[model samples]
Target: MTQAIDRVRQALLQAGHPDTIAMFAEGTHTAAEAAASVGCSIAQIAKSIIFRSGETPILVVASGVNRIDRAKVGAALGRKVERADPAWVEATTGFAVGGVAPVGHLAPALILIDEDLLALDPVWAAAGSPSHAFRTTPADLVRVTGGSVANVKA
Candidate 1:
């Protein structure tokens, strides 16, 4: 495995996940791409969105079918949040835009899980690369990220 993917596997192991990483012959960068690759509903794809809440970085794992509302995010945290740029995202999360995972970030990040994701049994999250992913429950994502569940969807 590549170092990027290896790190994710190690982190999941440390987090007590059941080791469910899967690789695709083709890239699955977008939610639609991932869902098609895994033959699951688009909503089952947990799309990770990182934002700049001032100096703090926040990772919101939301359902693919839902649109993330920045107003809802700001209301939830009592502060406005904007999407982080690619440079900031890579620097803070140690991964590029398309493959940022919910956990194993290079630095500490405040995480938020979409309440809608909890309705799904096996949510697929980007592992470390666009071509890599892992199956997880919404509860597992919450537990691993130590993030709060919120209505982040519009």
Candidate 2:
């Protein structure tokens, strides 16, 4: 398969995100790295965290500043939540940990968008590669991921 970044770019385009995918010379493997590269606040970086709910993968689109409360996740999903390992993250999303986008999954997973992101405009998210990012509004993210708005932050 081609690089996951390309798939992310296509997904963004197809989902009607206003901005194109941005690739930095420096890798955005972490929210702090992406923040430094994009000149945005760390809070403005959206991280896609995948957790296993039995057989299903749940993608939590959260702000960099917040830690996902797994207990809250369980409450939201009404099931036990298990963290996905590196191999599972890759196999489920077709992207590595630092590069998972909110869309273009190999299969659709239930998504939860952190309510914190809604307070900020023009947040940046991983574009299927550690070196690529995309600018998007919280509304667009909800649209692209078909995510539900929730307080998943800790």
Q: Candidates' TM-scores?
A: 0.94, 0.95
Model 1: residue 104 alpha-carbon error in angstroms:
0.6
Weakest 10 consecutive residues, lDDT, candidate 1? Answer: 1-10
Q: Which residue segments of model 1 deviate by more than 4 Å?
A: none
Clashing residue pairs found in predicted model 2: none
RMSD of each: 1.3, 1.3
Per-residue lDDT of model 2, residues 1-154, tens digit only: 2468778877887877755688887888899999999999999999999999876889999998899999888888788898999898899889889998888888778889999999998899998888888999998999988898988888
Error of 1 at 72 (Å): 1.0
Candidate 1 lDDT over 5-52, as tens digits, reads 777788899999977889886776999999999889999999988998
Error of 1 at 56 (Å): 1.7
Please report the TM-score between candidate 1 and the true structure: 0.94
With a 3 Å backbone cut-off (N, CA, C), the pairs that clash in candidate 1 are: none
